[model samples]
Target: MIELAVIALRGVQYALISLTFGLPAFVLLNRPHLDERALQGLRAQVGWATGAMVVVVPIAILAQTALMAGSWSGALDPQALLVVVTGMGLGVALALRWVAALAEGLLFAFRLKGRGFWFPAVLLGLVSVVTLAWTGHGAATECVGKFIHQGSTAVHAAAAAFWIGALAAFLWLAFRPIEPGSEEEARAAAMLTGFAGSGTVAVAILVATGLVNTAFLVGPSRVLQLPQSLYGGLLILKLGLFVLMLALAALHRFQLAPQMAARSAHALTHLRRSLLVEFVCGGLILALVALLGTLSPPMAM
Candidate 1:
């Protein structure tokens, strides 16, 4: 039960982390050009949503650290407190910047052509990369070869962001309402397809790097045995959810999306439901991630 709970928590943590990074990218990519009202509407929605995340994510971090660190006596352990506070501060700031970059990307994408789009897009991209790199760099526990470790870790983090972000973006755009004879719908559909195609390379990087990192942390023998262990079991559960998400993505990308693009309402409805299911499952997977981060892996124990 403890193992299960830990796994659940880790899943949530990772999922939230993924969401924190990915939501902005998703928002930015889907921003509508040629429509000022739609762009403004998206900006407003993102602003409120990002603001809420900023507030909640830190609280969640504190709650999580307190839980992980267990009881504190009269005087808090300064190092523990510092670590927790700094980590949370860094993460929250990065997350906020990520959202900002996304919003900026949308603004640039819609309003500016050529160089204007390139500048904001480049700025946002660099910020996202740096923030993610920092998050990844923080994962290494040892000081030996810290730079090398951090660099590898950054690659891993970026890969996960790309995969998770692509999946999230695909889910978001594919499910939204599509009206027949509406240019908005057609453009959205085109964007969905284009984005999905672009995301495929990111997905590949995510999977490959993830495997490498997992291999480094857990040897092949233990990796095979992970499902029997507490942390392993939870990891497996998250993997299952990921697979389900992928399946839904495939359905939408290959089957439903094209059908909807062809003006099939029935296909569009199915795509929406499928994407919603994937999103729910993604949430569950994230909860498990939160738990996983708190648990001791078999090797560590």
Candidate 2:
């Protein structure tokens, strides 16, 4: 039961952190091409996501404390909190995440604009995701191996944030009441189309990094034991969900997107449904990831 709570908290933390960075970066990248109303919508999403992170991050930290100490009561212990905030790797990472979350709150509160504000805000968000590497397996290694693993994991996390977080953003756009054949609909379609190229690239990176991380966590010898182990089973489930997400993404790129671009009737409705399914799938993947983080891989044993 405690483990389940940890997994749930971790999943929410990952999702919210991903969105905190992903939404702002998406808006920054596409703001020029988006209509005024669309840009405003994106900004609103960013604010909401950032605000959410403010509340989620501290709770996640406390959950992590409990998980590490093996009891809920440990979460309130000053020494445990001090260790989490000051210890190497994960401890430092958690402290950094807290600082980043606070920074985001300040940005959201003031409605800071211009390059100065946005540039720093986006950087902080990216840092928050990258620092997550320290909380996982990457931090267990030493010297050069640690550096290589942490670097790859950071890239993997960033790419994932870009892909999955943008899906959430796109899902928001799909719900807007843009009439078929209208300028707003056309702009929305173009945005989705543009995302296809970047999304594909992100997926490719995710796949490659996934393979690398798998090699580190579950070597070739453990592959045969996958079905026999809980960690391996969950890993397989995650991969299956990832493949499903890929299929849905392909449909979006080749089928629904094209129809929407052509202003076909019912295209928007179909696309919206597909986006919602994809978002749900993404959430499942994150949940699996949270669970996996708590279990020992077959190879590690």
Candidate 3:
């Protein structure tokens, strides 16, 4: 029950942090393609997310402390909290993450005169993602293995964040009713079309890094027996969702994108709905990841 509560608290953890990183990347990469309205909207959303993350990080640490102490009351113990903050890997990482979050929030709030402060925001965002690598299974490995494992994890996460960010941006752009031939519609199509090359690169990185991550977590000997364990089942479920997302992405690129280019009447509507579904799948993947991170792998058992 206690663990379940922790899992519930962390359900959106990945998505939340990823957005703080991905939103900046999206805004910067596609800034020219976006109108002032879209750019401001993204900046506002990311600012809020960064600020929210400052609060969420503490709550997450407290919840985690409770899980460690086996009760909510122990999480409040000052000595216990100090011990956690002092620890090198996870604790220190969390501290750095919080600082980055704070810095980002402050930068976003202040806003530079002509251009926004996205340059620093993007760098801090990368820092935040790197710190997260310390909190996962990759951090458990030793020596050279630790470097490889954590490195792959960080890249995988960054790629995933970028892909997810693009999907989110597309959804937001298309959510409102778009004029069939307005600049907004063209902008929307351009954003979708522009993502094709980057999306393919992201997929390649995600696939390669994903395989690398899975190998470290579930060794070859344990592969044959994965079907019998809860971890295995959940992993399979995650993989299925990923494949589904790929297929949906293909639909977007080939079918919907073409319709959008041709100025089909319902292109925006259809793309919006499909992006929503794909977004949901991405959410599910993150949730499953939150749960999976807590579970002991079959290889370990």
Top candidate, metric lDDT: 3
Please give the CA lDDT of all the candidate structures. 0.56, 0.82, 0.82
Candidate 3 residue lDDT tens string, 1-301: 6788778656666787778888778777788788777877877777777878898888877877777788999999987787787864777777888899998887856765224577777888889888778988888878898999999999998998878877777777788667886778777777777778888999999999998988888987788788899999999999999999999999988888778877888888888889999999999998998899889887568
Q: Best-fitting candidate, measured by TM-score? A: 3
Greater-lDDT candidate between 1 and 2: 2
RMSD of each: 5.6, 1.7, 1.5
TM-score of 1: 0.70
Task: Give the winner by lDDT: 1 or 3.
Answer: 3
TM-score of 3: 0.95
Per residue, candidate 1 scores C-alpha lDDT tens digits across 2-80 of: 3344344334435544544554555555555325555444344434443444445444444445554764331155665
- In Å, residue 283's CA in model 1 sits off its true spot by 1.9
Count of backbone clashes, every candidate in sequence: 21, 0, 0
* Per-residue lDDT value at 118 in model 3: 70
Q: What TM-score, computed on C-alpha atoms, does each candidate reach?
A: 0.70, 0.94, 0.95
Name model 2 segments beyond 4 Å from true: 114-117
Weakest ten-residue segment in model 1 by summed lDDT: 1-10
- How would you encode candidate 2's per-residue C-alpha lDDT over 1-120 as one tens digit per residue? 667776787788789878878877777766755766776677777677777777776777787788888999989998998888787567788678878978877876777775555577
lDDT of 3 at 246: 96
Model 2 scores a C-alpha lDDT of: 0.82
TM-score, cand. 2 vs. native:
0.94
